[model samples]
Target: MPVSQQRPLTFFGVAFAFLATMLGTTLPTPLYPLYQTQFGFSQLIITVIFAAYAVGVIAALLVTGRWSDQLGRRPILLGGLFAAMISDAVFLQADGLGAMLAGRVLSGLSAGVFTGTATVAVMELAPSYLKRHAALAATAANMGGLGLGPVVAGLCSRYLPDPLWLPYLLHLGLAGLAMLAIWQAPETVTRPERIRLRLQRLSVPTEVRAVFVPAAIAGFAGFSVLGFFTATAPAFMGRIMDVSNLLAIGVVAGLPFFASTVGQLAQERVPLSYRLPLGCVILLLGVVAIGAGIALASLTWFVCGAVVAGIGQGIAFRAGLGEVVAASPLTRRAEVTSSFFVVAYVAISLPVVGIGVTARLIGLQATGEIFAALVALLVLMALVLLRRQRRPVMP
Candidate 1:
């Protein structure tokens, strides 16, 4: 269909596609323990396997993050779906660490393509009056889909016949459906009569740096908390709290994301000047709560901390994204957004890897304390920056 033709349901269809792709990316979170047992790998190996996905994400962000601007949203989204399907296939046949790592890399590629493109596509497809609503829908789809992945996998793994095989198979089926949605959805990008693709370097404009830096920092801190829960919280729950139920583990791991969704929704009402700093303060409190939970080994404290931290992350991420997106010109929006994601993914990968290594050295509990303390410190720094920026100019 031509870009001019519009479908009323197109917005929802694209959002669903976003949800499906993200679901595939995080489907393995609750199943990591099973992979460890089957493949006989250490915690560090587990984190390495997880980090492989982030590596792929970073590569894709640097290479093709802005391609959607030239090629159109539907094609990039379809390509993402295809990559996700391949990742699912790898997981279905995964026999060892290498296979799992490959699957993660492929999944990351799919996510990297989808992240900025899907958000923009959804916003563009919305009726002029509903752009803000579309933004929320897109954000919800991103975080909600990620949050749902573990729940779906955990439920299937706990109750179904084939734990590991079932989740991937189901995700593959979802990917197929998402592909169909993209096929029918209207293209949001305007195509030139003749197209020439060129390598686009990842660069953030100087004009956007002030807003981008603090927002990116807040995103880094928020995503770090998410990374810890998704990558290591399952293991922590099993080893520290003696909670081995797959469903329980998945729910606890997903809490931060769920809370993040709530936080984002809440941010829409807050004044922009106050939102970022306020988010940082909440994030600091959440991190402290998590540390206390770890120190005491209390499930209640941990879960509570997850909820609090998630809310903070959600608020800060939305505020940061809003600032960066607002600061960028339309021509550079996708590149800038992708740059933001690069920072967020690095935060996701490095901190988790650090925890994995530190856990090996200092033990999980102590590692949790250290991670919490460091993240809290980062949030504080972000908070200070936002507050300083907010101060009235003394003429």
Candidate 2:
């Protein structure tokens, strides 16, 4: 197909593949409560299980982060999809806590590989006539895929006869289809022979340093919001509020990502100077609502807070990412981007683990209040920094 003709299919393929990878990541969201009951684990262990996936993601980003740029997008994506398939298999056969952890680890590995590579592929595959659409493809595939994951898994778990088995089974089918689509897609890398296997050290170079510090901190704060949903929110819903509906849980978990998508969509209208600061202010509102929900033990407050905070996370996260990507030199784009991801994943992992600790010591509700306060303070700091600096004129 001509480049111009490839837009629709490229968007579909990239979006489909992106969602498949994220579905593998969140496939276990609604199931965490089930695992707690089945394996008789503590809440801390649930947080630990989620953290294990973050470990896999960070590890993969550090070691093979730029492999796609070298070896070509197709092989890396194919491997990612295949890894997701194995992860689904692990979930399907999970009988113990170890198997569940193993499945999550593999799922994270799949996501780690796919996130960066598939993003570039989507951009590269855009039709010549629709070249400008690549940005939308990349952003939508990312945030949209994340939002779709829990929704898809949640629906399957609620309606399907065997909740655990059926969700993975459905995901397994989706992964297989994604794999087929990827395999048949055109190879964008021209001189495949020049590519070589190499390990990447995740580092922020001198050139990226000036912009890297604030950008990374902003990313950390934004991703911490995601950490709340992916790791702690569902447990909060069930344990504190006594709500146990799988679909409802999924919706709550998905709200931030959906809001993030909205943030990205609204990016064009919002000035860069305003995006981060305004996003932080909105994020603070979310933290407040979440804290309120926990204190009052009200599900309504929790859901509302999630939507508001999610919009903030979406706005600030994209702006921070855009600044970093735009600032980095072309040759170092992938490495720098991977470093940003490393920072973001760490934000997601470490904070949630800390919350688990606080929940154990103080109480889940109390810990939630503390977490919200800390995040709110962080956003305030980001805003302070934004105000101190002069705005750069956009090209």
Candidate topping lDDT: 1
**Cα RMSD (angstroms) for every candidate in the order listed:** 2.1, 2.7
* Model 2 per-residue lDDT tens digits across residues 349-386: 89998988888898998888888888877877777667
- Candidate 1: segments with Cα more than 4 A from true spot: 1-6, 127-132, 328-334
Clash pairs, candidate 1, are none
- How much lDDT does each candidate structure score? 0.88, 0.81
Error of 2 at 135 (Å): 2.0
The Cα error of candidate 1 at residue 302, in Å, is 0.7
Best candidate, TM-score-wise? Answer: 1
